[model samples]
Target: MVASCATCQQKAQQVKAMQTNIDFWPTTLKLKNSSDLICDESLRYLAGKRLVCRGRWQQRTVAVKLFFHPKSAKRHWLREKQGVESLISNQLSTPSLLFAGTLIDGTPVLIFDYLSSAKTALDVWKELDNDEARLDLLQQIVVEISAQHRCGLWQQDLHLGNFLISDNQIYTIDGDGIKSSTDGKELTTKKRRNNLALLLAQLSPNYDHLATPAIEHYAATSQKNMRDLKSITEKELPHIRTTRRHKYVKKAYRNCSEFIRHNSLRQVAIYRRDADAGLIKQFLNNPDQLITDGTILKNGNSATVAQVTIAGDSLAIKRYNIKGIWHILKRCWRPTRAWISWGNAHRLTISGIDTPQPIAILEKRLGPLRTSSYYLCVHENTPSATDYF
Candidate 1:
């Protein structure tokens, strides 16, 4: 429900108490902008000479987003709500919403606690001179992005500007551009590819040229986020050793630990990244197999492609036809995936058995992919996919 002015005032008070750094209800109480709503001027001084902006509104500090026109308010609201619901339903991490509303002047406003020390990667990039330091920051971002996809959610507009870095970690501020699945499956391949492209573009110095090494680096890290989340939530949670002597005590400890781990991973994945068209292009050569035919998928540019289905309806795949050989290599890093693969392989070897019963490795030097060496293995399911979720 839309919050009332009294509720907004109460929220502002709570935010005042929580934030020892900035006071929203400063003694001065200045309405900094008397002009019509401007995008950059969305932030202004409030009571006690405190600063706040427009975006998502709540009781504490409001996000003064540039609505531009009222005709689009309904669309924006639905998009924002979908994004918020995905994170909240999955128990993923993000800032809680206090309220959303429009000003008397027809300007859109969102109020919530004004976070301290939350800077975007782009904000940090401008401050750094060393290449290594910048790369480290981007790597963390890619990791977070990958985690988000693994959780069956997509950041519809993944970009550096939309992310906020606080306390040595990342947080997402723009919730109006997120996508999700009805059944909560992992993000589609198309989404991953587009996100990688966006990351590459942002990190690259040459706007016109795509960097193969940078793309590869991002892909590797992105894959790592997925693997890490899977291991923690799906793989490790159920295996906690228990003792009969202290059954209740052990059970309680296990439950608590699992909750902490799962939520921690979810927070890392959901709150720190933004996604878009560029990223999807980098991760896949074809993004059409991700959804079903006649299924409406959102597209940033160009027409939305029909979804491809396998085995009638049980499985669906989305594919993208990425252009340029140089572009493809620049966006295919798989470091995180490799690490997880190696770790899994090591664990199986240590157990003196094949992890997937040593499934046959079929050798093939076919298809557009330029790889002559590849292997596939199958494993018995102890706890199936649904069980873990």
Candidate 2:
């Protein structure tokens, strides 16, 4: 509605075009974020008003988010929204907060900094060619997420898409899960249960046969990944070796080891940048917060725009590149894709569709375009295990 430059005007016009006749095409067909498009709930909110999907208020490249439905006032939505804004405002390397306001429909709209080099969980697993890199990514995720928990924010949902891996450190993206409480252990247990329920709900009458022992194994391994956050204040993470009584635990460890052997990131060395060190250090010393990876499903695209596949019941990989300001800018230009992909995966997983157990996400900066990448993986898919890396 307001503008001062040519870039602003271009963005405005594009948003206008996207909404005009959105129903004319297939939902599967993707479009540029601009161009006046109506998408999901945002489209419902714009039913009467002719609002455009303009870029963020301060940055020309950031995405514009509008909320038409507001969570209960007593709920944590408002509080978390404020918290996220404050965190990002301090120049924290987390996702940039561009805008937050309530639409006429009462839904809370949130705009965020877009990282172009960012890749989703689906992207990484689909592109992953080996297991070593996958295992390496998983290990880094465990360390980084453990560090986040120490920062006083419990990322309720540790799914893969919630973070971006670049420069050997994980940068959190979604903040809905960030909380004020220091209940890392409790939150981890709840999230694990939530994920399990979601999986079971989507399985068939032969759930056991369909999910296989590997599914339970993956769950136990994921559970162990959160063990480091038990106290959140120890000098170092405690060792969590598999024990006999913990059948699921043993299965989980075996599954993780196998998955890492096939789909890991290889000998790719992680390169950390000086600029990101400050943000990384903030959570490193905290004792109450914990961060976890988003679940990588079987969809999404990559930076090179390469087509990826998690065919069969094997783990997959998806990757992206993030570095300077320009790269982050590119991510803002298109914000709906990740949200959309995430929605689809959640729906499929909840609707009894055969999906994989998303374990870890790998975010790191290597070297050139070929070296920089992101990775997310799953355990198995259907009846048979083809590439269950």
Worst 10 residues of 2 by lDDT: 235-244
Each candidate structure's TM-score, on Cα atoms with residue i matched to residue i, is 0.41, 0.37
Q: Pick the candidate with the highest TM-score.
A: 1
- Superposed model 2: Cα runs more than 4 Å off: 1-59, 70-80, 83-92, 102-107, 166-169, 182-389
lDDT of each: 0.43, 0.38
Judging by lDDT against the true structure, name the best candidate: 1
What RMSD, rounded to one decimal, does every model reach? Answer: 23.0, 22.5
Candidate 2 lDDT over 192-265, as tens digits, reads 33333332232232332322233334434445543432332121111111111133223322222112211233
- Residue-by-residue lDDT tens digits, candidate 1, 1-389: 24554454454454334233333323222122432322222243333212345432212343443232224544665567568767767666556655455544433444444566677778897798876776677667766776677787767656687677878867765678777767778766655655555444334333212234344455575554443232221222222211111332232222221111112311111000112223223213223334334354444332233333333422212222234556446433422222233335434443334454221111111233321111212323267579888
